[model samples]
Target: MIVSLIAAVSADGKIAQSAEQSSLDWTSREDTRFFISKTKEIGTVVMGRKTFGTIGKPLKDRRTIVMSSRTGIEGVEWTSEPPADLVARLEREGVTRMALCGGAAIYDAFLSVGLVDELFLTVEPVLFGDGVPLFRNGARINLKLLETTKLGDSSVLLHYLLLK
Candidate 1:
């Protein structure tokens, strides 16, 4: 299966300034619109449990899958840490491609396992002094350029093919 990572970060690579999910408000309108557009390209999306917790709900008009060890979450399919089984289930469901919209840990997990196919990043203008890094514990991985587009006044989206 082909997988991709999509996210927006500050100039210095911070996903958010604080633990408050609402703190992502610093992200630009153009970036958000681009992200929404990208989502329409795929029918299913895969995200970490923490990301779903931050967002509060599944995105409409798409089948959302959440990776988590526990259950009882509404509007989401719970998954376990060893994603091998979860990935098999997804394949059985005929999911050809998936995107990773994250909170860092998920990125690390997928990257470490060599599952990511592409990386889509929106670089914003401003930078917070300190905050959550995009790939907190992810090991170094190489990528080949796929596409790049500029957005608004000070934002750009860079797409790269993940090198396994």
Candidate 2:
């Protein structure tokens, strides 16, 4: 199974303004395009409860799974322990490639479990004075370079693979 962590962060690693969950509009246009393109390659996406709330519904043309303690949501599969178990369940459901989309907490969850096989990072050009971090607390995992690319005017794609 290929578990991917996909996100756009500022050059300094902040994902959004600390006080605002809705003010991530400055990440940049090219980066957004680049991110969509990156996500197109995956068949399923896993996100945190908050991230799913922000998106409002399941994404089109892909199998979407939201992780949380609540189990009965129509579109969500409950993900409680060893977050990797979520990935495994998804794989059982015919999802071979899954991307971890985030509001920070989910990204950290996937990272902590060493389930991330690739990281599709888009480095936006602007920096926020204060913002939510891309990750707060998570387990340590090592990585190996897979590939890198220059997307456009101000965005770069840093792709990596799990070391193991």
Q: Count the backbone clashes (under 3 Å) in each candidate.
A: 1, 3
**Best candidate according to TM-score:** 1
Which lDDT value does model 1 have at 159? 93
Tens digits of per-residue lDDT, candidate 2, 96-116, equal: 788788868888777766677
Cα lDDT listed for each candidate: 0.79, 0.73
Q: Give per-model TM-scores.
A: 0.90, 0.83
Local accuracy of candidate 1 as per-residue lDDT tens digits, 1-164: 77778988888988777655653578789988887778768767888777787787888877788887787467867777465666677889888877788767787787777778898899999888788887766478888998889999889999999776
lDDT of 2: 0.73
